[model samples]
Target: MKIDREKLHSPFVEQVERVSGEVFANCYQCGNCTGGCPVSFAMDYGPSQIIRLLQLGQEQLVATANSMWLCVGCLQCYSRCPKGVSAASILEALRQMTLRKGEDHEDVGGLPFPFLKDAPQQAIISGFRKFVS
Candidate 1:
């Protein structure tokens, strides 16, 4: 629960700031993102919590959280946020950080749904391949 901010370093934070400075920096921990998140029940840390963690440079929490990969990218929290924080985009950035660090979700991989078989999954996979390749 405690982040050693001195240890955190990454260029991706700059990318997040560039793309979502208003929303990412304006978060007041109102928990609105978590309240509006349709998939909060399925996440280890809700959307707002992730943002708070990231703000504190808690890269371990963000990198290790399985919820980063669980995000459906529905953008519900982004659309509903009063602060205009794109919760979904924040989740995506966390997911990218996790992947860049080689964090893997073995449990998610064992799920019955084949990511390639689902259209949304396919789209995500395609996008990831494009971005990470």
Candidate 2:
């Protein structure tokens, strides 16, 4: 986690803000979002950590992480955020950014059909909508 501050600039951070309309910088690294996230155990970084990374100007690191897909549009983080940061929407925006570039962070294509066959309909649709080329 050695961030070369000189290399920190715009691009991804600006897009996150522009897309999610959430000022992630206002986040105070509180654990509320992470504690409230139902899928935090499966995520490499939780909702609060995501905001922390964004605030630290590690937008690319956050964007490339697999944690974004773990948010199943659950608004618990958003609801619990004292700073009004929409953590779910920010993750959604990351997914949107990845999708817009014809890429996927979750690698759904790597999973076999049978592995995903029993997945919920909502999850399948959401995955497709976010990852399909």
Candidate 3:
């Protein structure tokens, strides 16, 4: 991907930076975030990849990824980051952006009955909080 000046300074990037309060440019592709993430195994794109896509001005790709929705906001990424970039915060910004567009990441009605029945109440509530608008 050819990252040009226009892409780097794009409105989408600006909005993400403003909302996340973290500079994407500061991230240098270090994999600490993904390595430390407990739930990264279940994500389509790891935290580091999400930031990389954003850095490459691939906001549309980032927007379409399920990575942001899977983030548990544990801040393990932040704790392991050398530049103090919080992937959790970036994911939250992406989620906010998606929510602002009136799109829900998950459908409560579409959730599987087995998982719903077996999952802890707190986990279910947290899923609703994160996946619902």
Residue 109, candidate 2: alpha-carbon lDDT: 65
Off by over 4 Å in 3: 111-119
lDDT at 24, model 1: 55
Compute the lDDT for candidate 1: 0.69
Residue 95 error, candidate 3, Å: 1.0
- lDDT head-to-head 1 vs 3, winner: 3
Put down candidate 2 lDDT per residue, 1-133, tens digits, no spaces: 6566643446777788899998876888878988998999999889888887887788667876788876888799989988888899988888888788887555766887886888888978876776665
- Candidate 2's displacement at residue 93, Å, is 0.6
- Mark the regions of model 1 whose C-alpha exceeds 4 Å error after superposition: 3-23, 100-133
**Quick one: how many clashes does candidate 2 have?**
0
**Candidate 3 Cα RMSD (Å):** 2.0
Q: Per-residue lDDT for 1-133 in model 1, tens only?
A: 6556463334545555555443456898888888988889888899888887667777667666766667777888888788888878777765565556665544444545665466586776665553441
- Judge candidate 1 at residue 125 and give its lDDT: 69
Superior by TM-score: candidate 1 or candidate 3: 3
Candidates' RMSD to native:
4.8, 2.7, 2.0
TM-score of each: 0.67, 0.81, 0.86
